[model samples]
Target: MDDQTRLELEAAAFRRLQKHLMEDRTDVQNIDMMNLAGFCRNCLGRWYQEAAAERGIEMSKDEGREAFYGMPYADWKANYQTDSTPEQQSAFKESFAKNVENQTP
Candidate 1:
């Protein structure tokens, strides 16, 4: 595939992933996802922020978060986030570095 075609394909795949996360995967908690898979909605927000910066757009972190979460991030956290257990927190801290390594730009 040519460069444009490849970028288009990648963008499509990213949209599908975002759609699935927003619509199909409500049961997954951010902390649990962080512990197990390494990243969560907030990570996507940060990536969005970075992307905007790369393109010379000065987007705030909260704006990027709103774009990813579909509303203000504080609202999403109030509605969706639960109190994580001690064990979960411990595991998350321990696994954070490995998880960060796995995330793609």
Candidate 2:
């Protein structure tokens, strides 16, 4: 496939993943996703922000999150986020250390 087609396909896949998480699976907590998959919706937003920076677009973290979540982060938390159990928090610490702490941006 050509470069434009590849980019479109990747964007479509990302949109599908976003829909799956935001619309289809609202019950999946961010902390659990971090523990299990090492990334979550917030991470996706951060990546979106970073990509905008790379292209000279000025997008704040909150803006990126709103763009991805389709609402304010606080609102999303109020609506969908649940408190993490101690076990989940512990696992998140280890997972974050392994997957996110050492990464250099």
TM-scores of the candidates are 0.85, 0.95
- lDDT string, candidate 2, 1-105, tens digits: 999999999999999999999999999999989999999999899889989999999999999999999999999999999988899999999999988897765
Error of 1 at 75 (Å): 1.8
lDDT of 1 by residue, 1-105 (tens): 899999999999988888788778866788888888878888888899999999999999899988888899888778777889999989888777676666556
- Native-to-model Cα distance after best TM-score fit, residue 55 in candidate 2, in Å: 0.6
Clashes of 1: 0
Q: By lDDT, who's the top model here?
A: 2
Backbone Cα, N, C clashes tallied per candidate: 0, 0
TM-score of 1: 0.85
Query: What is model 2's C-alpha RMSD?
Result: 0.9
Error of 2 at 70 (Å): 0.9
Candidate 2: residue pairs that collide:
none
